[model samples]
Target: MAFAAACAAVLAAGTAPASAQAEPALTYIWPVHGTIVDHFRPPAHEYGPGNRGLEFATQPGSSFWAAARGVVSFAGPVGGRLHVTVSHPDGLRVSYSGVAGIGVKRGERVHQGQLLGTTADRLHVGVRRGEVYLDPVLIFDGDASTGVRPPLSRPRLVPASTSVYRLQLRWLHSGAGIAVL
Candidate 1:
């Protein structure tokens, strides 16, 4: 169906906002004043073991800042490590792990530079478009982790092999395809 084809296109192009013309502009702060120590590495499949976010080497207890304006979907411990997940506008969500000294509450909206929490040896930051994990570094101007000043390029998405894509193709062939929006 035509609807299914559109859904497939959207998935192939990554989870950009509905209003996205080129790549979606990620207007966000660095969230913490730390050196980039790690980067997002996509796995062969969803739920597989992989580092789906970036890690920043900060002090023992550096406070983390909100990357953009959005509501806090979750802020608590995951596997005993403190974490925060913020649902930003346009179905985008940013998450911070290894946080401490929680200062924000769940369901509370935050701004671009608002304080979120403190960090440990390294802060893990992940960006998600809907349920798909994205490279947190993709939104930044350059790879600060390496201390390089290279020019930034257009945002490119990390391809994911989730069930959604498999189902999309199945639906399109079975005349049951549907758009998520």
Candidate 2:
């Protein structure tokens, strides 16, 4: 009976709280230090008009860095605006638009805090997982002293699916030339 009780105790010890066994949280930083001119506003529908990212008002020539390590999935002009996108290992894709210059190229691996490029008057940073766009403010770590506040809620992660393939095709048709990383 004592041996059986010991076995049960061991089994119970293995079942820890979910938080104790959870995966390490991904750490992200701001791409650029500036005032948030525009906040993320999810569209009513996928194709509806809305601000899908955060817009920072910084000096026109100020340089922006990669928020996290990832591969340069797309770097070029999109709808007349210069953009650079990094596909993070965590399955998150971060796109920096309104760049005045391009420092990285497609398929190039970039480290966190690496120089991405310079922005024009403002920089637009977007984050996505699969087909669902996430709020950049939630993913990034912001300090109140810098005028950036911590995220009020957790981000919802959607699994990657065929929608990702459709997104690539859409970009291709739009002449963005964004290939899978």
Candidate 3:
């Protein structure tokens, strides 16, 4: 009787369905082809202690790719740079800022590594999971193995739903804010 009960229990646990035990892990690709100069630092600028993001120091007109597949939520000018943000279905958001111009629009679907925009020395990039913003460096898997040690550490993530912060950008080229949404 004991052996039968143990076997039943194991079967029940294993057959419950894999979806219930799955955790969503959203990963993004490198937004631009430039080397990472400035990483996501919450306190590096005037955004106070919890504004996390990265700045890609690249040349002007370099293509910016979608880090992951997502839906474009907000695409416009902020801090004098062309910015585009894609909200994934898994509750993660990826942002591309400091670009020369945007190729995606609000409410459009974007694939992984899709052409979203172009970056420059002034381009800023970021990723957020739920209300918590993560260090952009943590998502890059090849950096440490490739002998490129990132200077940033994993921050104690805080709720980012209310933290609608902005980066004070230095533009690479002048442009106006135009949108489809």
Candidate 4:
């Protein structure tokens, strides 16, 4: 294949092996340009009723795009609303409800801002990591004027102290030990 040949040529020139490809980023944007009518409400209990996603007030038949790049997990009518669930590579699933029509099918990969469906009376956006429903506003900057697209911020990592070092030791049968840093 052309990719294999390219790697071979790079290696033959006394260069290092190609670096591992990175996973696609979790970029999210406003799926539709509308006023935020209802914000996400946390549930009182595990089975208590609560708003899991944000609801936008958009006109009927307005096109709604995907908030992030992911694979379509579900696309169909549920509870009298056309719902579409996209599973991101990071194990987070975003669900859109109150859509009129779905442009993407189940198992289809969608890019950020890709058209997913037509908005109905109300567009609901829900996010869940496993069974926990998260606040959708946490991903947005809260400053999207006229729905201007802005790349979502990546998750931050906990800072580590420079003087702190944790080591793992594994003993081998050859009377040697390996120290993993």
Candidate 5:
């Protein structure tokens, strides 16, 4: 009987939810160290082509972060995209574009609210799936300290790009690409 009881306890512990075992993931980070110039805008079409993600106003070399935890399915330079694509465990996929010196190769694991990439100072962001494009603010948790809200119509101050830039350098130094975690 004691053995059975111990087995039950072990099963219970093993099946615990991730949130119960780990700290909650940050839902969003300041896209750039500047006020949000534009808000997350959904595609204009009821069922046609349109913007899929949110847009923030930033200058060249601005840093961007992952809104949540996910696997880095692809990270490299496109013709002009120079983007990173993260696939969340929750079936959500986030993409960051308009970056340069593309860091973080494909197949890496990234934590929530971690730096994804940096972009040229004055660029707009676009996100999309097959046909359903939505606003990015919908996925971000607004912070009063930043003074930005959902349906953001103006700008909000963000943090400096230094921290993420340092992290990116470390990633690039690893050399070996195609990570799983």
Candidate 6:
């Protein structure tokens, strides 16, 4: 019947072939272990005076890391202060300012927790999704008070055979009382 065919089509569209499925969203970690000295404060207008990112109070020469796996988009001085920026796969650009010792270079691929540079007395971290700046506190998954990000969670993988069987079982149990084609 058309109704059954429509239902089957809808169900089929819900589950893509495993190879076509997207990977899980990337989880971000803290770039450095330090106490948060300042939080994000959005400006009233463009070029207005307001802190666009989080500031951490850390010891000079303390190592900082990439928040997530990404390519180094920039590593150089900005306004006389050293800075490093990583462009993530999710289109996020994370910038670390006030760094003293640089380790990664521009266009280089970096993994999560990989050392990018060392910070000075304070570290300024900024995140941007395109041109709009985002708060780093909300991006990283961890406790801001402890200044440590926990390990990333492992994704559960389901075998193709078992997944298909489970989907068929679900369809049958839905009271349609019809076997999937």
Best by lDDT: 6
Name the candidate, 2 or 6, with the larger TM-score value.
Answer: 6
| TM-score to true structure, per model | 0.63, 0.65, 0.59, 0.67, 0.58, 0.67
Candidate 6 local lDDT, 60-122, one digit each (tens):
998899888999999999889999999998888999998999998999999888889899999
Q: Tell how far residue 110 is off in model 1, in angstroms.
A: 0.8
lDDT of 2: 0.83
Q: For this target, which candidate reaches the highest TM-score against the unseen true structure?
A: 6
Please give, for residues 1-181, the per-residue lDDT of candidate 1 as tens digits: 9999999998978876766656455466567777777777888898688888888898988778887788999999889888899997757788998886789999998877787888888899998876787777655544333544334333423232467587667777775466432
Off by over 4 Å in 2: 1-25, 142-181
Q: Would you list the C-alpha lDDT of every candidate in the order shown?
A: 0.76, 0.83, 0.68, 0.76, 0.61, 0.84
Model 5: residues with Cα > 4 Å off, grouped in runs: 1-26, 44-50, 126-131, 142-181
Clashes of each: 0, 0, 3, 0, 9, 0
Candidate 1 has its poorest 10 consecutive residues by lDDT at 151-160
Model 3 error, position 97 (Å): 1.0
Model 6 pairs in collision:
none
Q: lDDT tens string, model 5, 54-126?
A: 5555777766766667788778767856778877665557777667545566788877656667777544444
Question: Which candidate order results from sorting by TM-score in descending order?
Answer: 6, 4, 2, 1, 3, 5
The residue pairs in collision within model 5 are 35-156, 36-155, 36-156, 58-121, 59-121, 60-120, 60-121, 107-179, 109-181
Tens digits of per-residue lDDT for model 4, 1-181: 9999999988888754457456655656667777788988888998888898899999999888877788999999886768999998777788999888889999999887778889888899998879988877765533222444334453422222343324322333224566433
lDDT of 3 by residue, 1-181 (tens): 9999999999997785766776556554566666666766666445567447777678888777777778999998887667899897667687877778788889999877677877766777777877667776666532322445334443322222222222212121224433212
Better of 2 and 3 by lDDT: 2
True-structure lDDT of candidate 6: 0.84
Error at 36, model 1, angstroms? 1.6
Runs with alpha carbons beyond 4 Å of true place in candidate 1: 1-26, 141-181
